[model samples]
Target: MQPSRPLDVVYDPLYTTSTSHNKYEGHKRRVVPNKRPISIKNNSGLVSGPERHKYFCRPVLPHLQAETPEVLYASAHDAANIMSISEDLSASTRSIGMQTMYRDSHAQTDPFSPEYVLPEGAVAPEIESLTNLRYRKGLPVTQAEIRMIEHNRKKKALKKVLPPMSDEASLNLRKRMMEAQEIMDLKFRENEIDEAHARRIEALQESLAEREKQSQAINSERMRRLEKTLMLEKEDANRRNQHDRIKELRKLANKRQRIQTILNQGSKKRDLIEEYADYASPVYAPQMRNGNLVRKSPVPEVQFKDHQLMTLDSIRELEKNLPPQIRTSPKNQFLKRAPLMKKSRDQMTMETHLLNVESAINKQHVQGEEKLPSSPYKGQYRAILQRPSTPNYAPQIAEAGSEVNALRLLQRLIRGRAVQNMMYEGKDRRAELIAELRESEEARRFLSSSFQVPAEETEITKSAFSHVEGEVVSELLDVLQKELIRNKEIAKVYDFAQKAAEDRHQREIEEGARRQLEDLARDRHDQIYCFVTDIHRSTANDYIDSIFEDAVEDLTYRDSVVQSIIMTKVIDPILNILEEENSEDTIVKDLVSSFLFPWVQKHHTQDQALLEKRKYTSAIQALLAKVSQSMRI
Candidate 1:
């Protein structure tokens, strides 16, 4: 019979509050040293746990309270039991709601790390708590089984029995049979062999006669035999004769060259002596043709003239006499070759330039006395002499006797004068100004900035039209100019539209690239995670098989070798799935506590499918859904 649980270990409500209505605070003293910060000051704690208030300060958690009735203040054994039960509850709740595996997957690891291979039994490592494994290879062997094993192995190798005349023994028997048959043939006599040979000879003769008859029944012409040997003999004899003749000619030519070289050497020595001695020979004298003799000089000068030559005398003369401007070394090599551009092209040479300067100086002296009227310019007042000296009392200059008409006076005195002075004055008044300027040539050449062509003399110069040389070229050039102008106008109007479209397209491309990068990162993470997950799924069966047969095996809850196997195998996978794709926010902690925790409580603890591992997969899927909801991924 199985033993029952001890009464001492069995737990019940340690105490029920004597007065359930009111609460008490100060669950413990706050003078304990701890690694974490404490809320103690001046030997006084905040009255409760880390979080406390006057009205709310009490035992922080109901489980934290060790309150017991005096009657129930029993022995240390009961206290030990209480502590153990409390520890178990705390451990179960302490799981981060996750474990070490979940923390590792989310950590910032080294970038250069090679992919890690997961240990066996990462997923539902064991199916049922009581299950074990057995393998057929590990069965026991016995001493009497040895011969039987060999016999069976041989039988399996062949798969059947051998027939009589089939193996190597059969081959040997065939070889012997062949030898016996060959020996039996030797019983025939030599005379029989000779008779057979004679018969073969007769057959050969008959075949030969038939072949001869066949050869005779053909059309034929006599062919001459080529004597290759005689042709080779004749070629050798001709070659020998030619070689002898060539040798004789070579010897004669060598003797003639030696004799000529000796004679030429003697003549060359005599010629050298004559050339060096410079004797008065007839060859030195020039021959006259008819009565004419060679000219004494090669060239006759047209006239005696002085000219510069590149010589030491010319260089010395330049050094002593030339001005610095003309004798200077080369410089300004990069300067463009352009004609000198004077401001006034009329003074193209030095004489004209000097004339222009002299005249400008005279004009400046003449106009130097010009001055302003006053600092405060008066718009109305002016010298009476320059004011046209209007008639003082309607002088009879208009000849009042002629007509006293108002319209005629307006036309003559106002309109007529204004038209004559302002409209057509260029024809008369311009000529008068030019005559006056000519009289005062000094003023005409004035350097005053205010001097300008009179308005009366102002004429729009007409452009001279020289007919363009190439009509086709001119037309094409005009078309090109018009095309360029038209294109510029089009671009000015529509360029902004094209630029805006290009900018929009570029932004779209960048946004798409950003999304692609995000997708690639997500896929990379999935690939790494899938590597681990594949191992986990594969080890699921291996874990089941390892229970008894394997040296090391993942324990189920019933046969736990480490901390609860459910934490590593079942709970960890769910947590990993939740952690891998989640941002892990606390905003949705209520969802996990209210929805997921309750679901696991209702399903995992009650469903029979946990034995079949369906509960774990379902639980993980549900957890993943909650995680996704929290992350909003």
Candidate 2:
């Protein structure tokens, strides 16, 4: 069976009232320490076990019924009992509110907090008695009452222990204290006088020091100013002398240069004034030829107004010939225009909406049938009077305007301002004609179909002009034969030329392909060369380092000879192989182990030679590895 949730813990009303309402305010008296915050789960349900069941009994929910007969019957009975108990509890709780039961609980705690402490004698006996009678409550002592009780107890105990002082002894003690105060006052005055004297002496010394510091600062400032002035005067004098000497030297140098120039080229020497005077020409003057120094004619100055007027005229001309303007604003858009002329057909003929002819015909046929007698119809019909076919007719339309207008004729013949204007007018006329043709139903119907020559015209023309005279035919044949012979010759020449062109184009294409191949080859060659150079440059230092390391290791003559032999044979060959395009790790290893190792072993069987050989081979391997790293391809 499942258990119900435990009751919530409620704080005692007396404790709540005693506790400070404002948590922020500081308490003068030490507050009664709270051991810990009250937990609703731990402290709730003070009355537990069978004692709790006597009052606020909560029934446990019955377990789910099982298939077994015994368990199922027991569960049914338990559920029934639990349900009845819950209903009764709910009824009781409804009458006496849940909060009233919580308030009636006996469990209570007190903190004696100072906030709820009442003034002395504030609660009269009569009021306390009335509260106890009406509310069935007892007055509990406030925090103030507790403190007062404690203080009075302490005071009574102290009064029984300590005796009061006599009046003569108190007066004598006061007199001694007064005499001691006088002596202290005299000593304090003497100390003040000493401090004042010392302060005066210190002030005098400070004043003297301040005066000395000011005088020294003033004297130093004057000396610095005097030195600066003298230094500036000396610099000015030196600068003036330098300037004078430079001027004199410059004048001498100029004179010497002028004399030298005159002697060498026989050209006239001019001073700054003369040089500037030669440039004294009007600002608006035309530039002259270098040697002539004279213009053949002066350039004419165009006026702004005339220039602007010419530009404006060109702009206006361009604007006048511009294409039709487009309407940008819908509000100002062009409205549909009235037809240029009245439509030729009537409104009824123009209407495209088709009428329901079947309805009309059926109505007419019904009326006719109704009017006629109903009779058995025969297959044969009597011959009736034939109706004459409607005479083929068309409306005879007269021209609306005068047949001949001299002014209109003259206007049509008048030449436009330019050929462009004439073409524009022609284009406008054609556009108008096309629009009119599209607007006309009959014309549009005729134009929608493919056009063909009239059969009558074709027959007439074929018969009339099909035959040619013998002489003319013979002449035409001769001319054609001559033309065909010429065309044949031309075709032969064209064929040869085309073949030549094709051959040349093929050669050019081949040449371009060859050149591209050469360029790619050259680029690859250059890249390889740069890679080789980088490898050589980067390995040069490593080679030197290896040789140095080898020299340090090998001190004897045979070792030196072995080193030289290794350098000339092993290292050089390995480097050459590393630079080669087909160089690989196997090839390098073969060069070092197969060729160099056997040669070294044959030349020198000593241990040092063997050691040097190993070092050289290792160095060669290192060099090859470094080169391999630096290799681009």
Candidate 3:
């Protein structure tokens, strides 16, 4: 049987067809439901609609019928009459509730109706199983019982592990354990040594194979080189044999040429002049191998002028007065002033020198300082460089755009022909502007045909009070149109000027550089000339002569002019050195002094300290220990 539902629904017997009023007694459906239509899902017969009641329980359950109706009626009647109290009420008030909600519910319902019966209390089951009953345990476990059990089982096991044996037995057991451990260690070490031996053998085999491979490669390379050498030797022998054969053929050709010449000559022998003429044929121009022109020396006497060919007396005097380096050193005599034509000189010396060494050194930072500043505004000048500069197209674009805009404005004014109308106001003026702009084919044809529009002239007398506004209007329009055309033409001219400036910028820069170079060269030439003149004048003066003889004795010369030239050339270098500015000289000199002084002083102090330590060395250790204390105090 299915489990009982929690909610029990009681059907009303009045809805069931009552047989009591008829001949039969039970209340049940009298009509049989039509054979149910088949369900497509389950293929089972179904009873649907109001006829489904015919399949409902028709059992004569008189037991439920007696109390079920009455209980249901009571519950529903109580629910109808009942009103819930609000949460605001006290619990005590609710517990001591008012009169029964169903006080008159029993009277409202048919208490004595034949179809209804009184409700009874729910019945209890008559039998129940007793095996699942729970009861208290017999006794509780104590600590003494737990201890007794552990002593019997756990204590015996622990005592067996940590045995209560004699010392000799324990020692015997340890000896056995040591023997087993030693045997195991020996086996493990043997395994490790075997592994190492196998690894070493494998490594040696690999190395041996690698060495064999290298040796084979070396042998192959040696054989290749030997074969290459043999090949080269064979090629060399072939070249030598070919050269010898060619040389012999050339000699035979010379013999044939001489015979031919003898036959051409009419039994005449050549003269000595003719024989030497071939040898004397003018050589190719005596010039630089690279085709540059060869320069000749300006000075007539080379060694004597340079002080290389000095007399014994001059040498002795020079040695006594001159510093070692200034007394014609080996470098001065062996200078490569003019090296062989085939070779470059160690030092290049021009025959006509424009810049002296002094000027060159002075112009290291600024080559043309006298003519040009170190830097200039680059935009104003043309750029002169090996590589081209990127162009700045912004100005070109702007100028072209402005010119186009001006031209467009001028064209619009000319084409629209609304000048007079625009000058005035009102709709009529605007209409006149439109009419003037509109071209008439008839007027164009008449003008092209050179025909005139015949009209009667109505002359009027001129008055002083006449309006002059219209008179100047045409003139003003003509002037305005001319000005617009002039502006566009001006813009075109300005654009041309800007382009010309950019295009010729490079040439202008080159010109400026050339001018600057010329100026510097002129200045240097004048400076050298003036310096030589001054030295010559000074040599003639008694005071200058006495001063040179006494203070500057090393540079004495036999020729006054040579001495003047040398002095001028030499003094300029000293002057350039004196003119130079060096802010770091003092700083670097002080730094060197600071470092040298401390280092030298430190060594001196160290030597002195050594002597002091020797003197104190023989003193007692106690005294030496107290020395630091004494110095500190």
Candidate 4:
């Protein structure tokens, strides 16, 4: 069996190595790989190890694993190259591919060369069944076929061991499926019911809202009608009052003219009668009976004075007999007397009473504690007569002239010294003038000082004025300086007091205006809150947008809008968040006070809008609390 040339290592399943033991042969072969060197000279050979197997076969594993129809031709080609069994195979081999294969008995080349030496104790590796026959024959072998076979075996094994489902199990599964279907149906019905209920509620809300709008419209109409009626009535009353006032004025004017004419007529008639009596005859004098003037009474016992004795009949008789001038005289016109209408009579009586009462009061006031009749006048009188008088604490305002006079005095002194120098320009009168001014200054200082003078006549006056005008200058300067100092002190005090009073007045005015604005804002807040929040959930932004353009000039409206914004934008959102998070009344309030209060304080601080919103803090907080409580309920 030994060959002279190195031969291909043809695979043989029955071949044994020197280290292998064969029970059938009843011999234990000795491991002599190092000595024998398992080459072509030796018949026994070692089997290929995993390294050799992988190097030769796994390189073509992908090609071998192909199961496509094209792989059939390749396999035939490989088969023909190895076997050379048929012409068709040979033709297929040459045409489809150029690959070659070897049979078990065929010799190609020895993987181990003749000179190769095996290592000591080397043994042939056991054959892997994965590459058994196909590898030995140099045919294609792959894991894909082995895996398919393994999968089929596992499937059959599982099928043989697994048990079938029982009737009870099938029934239980069917029951679960039916229950699931019933649950789905029940959920669908509940959703439908909920949707229908929501629709009904929405419809009811719409109807109620419509009714409310109608009622509001009717009420507004009634209110407008009532207002219009009241306005007409007021106008009518005012017009009637104006008419009555005009009539009363006309009557007064006519009464005044009649009184004036009567007064002039009486005066003229008296003057004419006096002139006639003095120049004409003694008969012109008022004729009198035994104890009466001019006319006797119808009753013999009745006696009257000259004017009272004259009757209407006598005046008419005189009018007819007199000349035209005397006939038409105003005295004879009885209609031109004092006003005889009741209203005019009443007015005259009132005036006469007022004058009489005033005169009596003056007489009583002037008489000094003398007892007199009580005054009939019940109206208020100024017991302490009001007149313009100086205040007790009169401020002494500094006169402008005082400071100017002091400055002028200094100027005058300086001018005098300069003039003195000019008069003695090149002479030595400077020392004399200095001595004279010094003497005058010393005398003035001594007099102005708080030193007591002697009771006896002092000779101070003799040394007072060293020069002609020095005495006047020193005295006037002292007075002016004192006046200037006093004026400054007065001015300072007056300015401080005036500033204090002005500040106080300003504060009072500010406080009053603030109070009025707060009152207005509060009223506006109520109106806006009622209008904005009266309906269901809605924001103030929509309402604000509707009115913002039209009501730009209305500050109250703007303030109300700002307040509503604060409620909706700031207050409502925070309240809703707090409500959703925690519904407890106490917890909600605490959260509002802790979180919302500070937030509102920080954000609601634009000056004009701030005043509008800050005032409603308490109201808004209460509203928040109320809303939270409602949500909880």
- Model 1 reaches what TM-score against the true structure? 0.14
Judge candidate 3 at residue 450 and give its lDDT: 46
For residues 1-633, write the lDDT of model 2, one tens digit per residue: 642522111322222335547342334222455466676356574767755545842255565632222222322235687798689887845554232322345644322211122334443222221221212222255553444455545544544444335687766765676576567557656766676656765675577679889999999999999999999999899779856865765575566555444333322222433432344432223245522244332334444565543687887876677765532324666888866543433333224212333444454565445433232232123233232333322232234235446556666666444666888889887997877776796756655552565878667756665554556788999999999999999999999999998678656655765688699999999999999999998899899999998887776767889999999999999878767846588677876898888878877768778898999999999999999989955
lDDT of 1 by residue, 1-633 (tens): 753643322232253345754232222222344455666445464366644433541243334322322112222345687798689787846543322322445753212211122223343211221121112221234432343355435544442333346789877866676565455445333544666556765565566568767665432211112345556777788668756755665565566456444434433223433532343422233246433344343223345555675588987977888788887876766967577665334235445545655665564464345442343233233222211222233367457655667668777889778877776777675888878878688654663422475544333211112234366679989999999999999998799889997678656655765678699999999999999999998898678776665534433534674557778888899988887867657536856788788888779766665666886788899999999999995
Ordered list by TM-score, greatest first: 4, 3, 1, 2
CA lDDT of each prediction against the hidden true structure: 0.53, 0.57, 0.55, 0.60
**What RMSD does model 1 have?**
57.7
lDDT of 4 by residue, 12-45 (tens): 3355555665443422233223374555485357
Alpha-carbon lDDT of model 3: 0.55
Clashing pairs in 3: 382-505
For lDDT, candidate 1 versus 3, the one ahead is 3
The stretch of ten residues in a row with the least summed lDDT in candidate 1 is 125-134
Scored against the true structure, residue 631 in model 1 reaches a CA lDDT of: 100
Which candidate ranks first by TM-score, i.e. highest? 4
Candidate 4 lDDT score at position 559 = 94
Quote each prediction's TM-score: 0.14, 0.14, 0.15, 0.18
Which lDDT value does model 3 have at 180?
A: 60
